[model samples]
Target: MKKLVFIFALSSFALTACSKPENKPVQESAQTAPQESAQTAESTAASQPLAAGDTAETSLDWAGEYKGVFPCADCEGIKMELELKSDKTYELTEEYLGKGAGKEFKSKGTFSFDTKNPSIITLDKAAENRKFFIGENFAEARDMETGEAIDSQLNYKLTKEAN
Candidate 1:
């Protein structure tokens, strides 16, 4: 439709107009030529590496296998294993034990880090909503919908497996 095209064009123009150019020179300079040159050099150095906007907060190492036994009401426990790979994919396996017939289930899918908190990860296209709060040598399960950590003495937690 003409209105939709107009809206799309308007949105693109607004985004481009508002976005800041990385290579733009600093407006203020020092009084002396030597100081000015030094300032420019510093500015350029600071901007060069970060022109693509890579930051430590957005990049984290969370690749490993985690295992634990979760408490279950009717069964002895639920044995859980989760593996996260560097390519943002994951494998999850679960086994219900001591319920007359032990059953195992495995799910494989891609995962993504939460934009607000990179330490939190969620499974994509999974049958059951699952979220993990990643920490040193451990990944803890949280409320699937709210992403809030469950509070208990015997918390549902997974320890990283030895490489």
Candidate 2:
């Protein structure tokens, strides 16, 4: 336990030493900032009511089932049903429409929101890094290769089903 504590102390010291140089400019500016300007900035910030920025990530009731028939090149269409849970897990089922003698393909896995863009989600281990852009009442499937919203006239959208 002594060795472990010493290693942790050394790691903390190294991290603090590495970060101090990068913070020098910000620290210098704060130290030299005018007192009156700082007071004015604080008062201005306090006077204005804080705006609640409600984004899709924070506001949308997104945990539910979504279903739609997406366009397919080889078959008539592809019917996909997806269920998103609050625990960052998902259940997906797909069936090729008008393709006879085939069973519904089902898969379940954990999903994660994009770190930089929380409005999008990608299911773990999905083919081609399949992603979806979540929006109001829909989760649109994005292009597998480009990871962008599909721009075709044919709808690739899944409508949220009322529970």
Q: Pick the candidate with the highest lDDT.
A: 2
lDDT, residue 23, model 2: 97
The C-alpha TM-scores of every prediction are 0.62, 0.63
Model 1: lDDT to the true structure = 0.79
User: What is the per-residue lDDT of model 2 for residues 1-163, given as tens digits with 9 covering 90 to 100?
Assistant: 9999999999999999989986997787777777768889899879985444445557888899999998878778888999999998899988887753265788888888776567788888853357999999999998765568777888988999987
The residue-by-residue lDDT of candidate 1 on 1-163, one tens digit each, is: 9999999999998877666452232222224667878889999998886432342224445688999999988888999999998887889999998983469889999887776666788887673758888887788998888788887777699999989
Provide the global lDDT of candidate 2 against the true structure. Answer: 0.83
Q: Please give the lDDT score at residue 3 for candidate 1.
A: 100
- Candidate 2: give the clashing pairs: none
Off-target runs (Cα >4 Å) in candidate 1 are 1-60
Count clashing residue pairs in model 2. 0
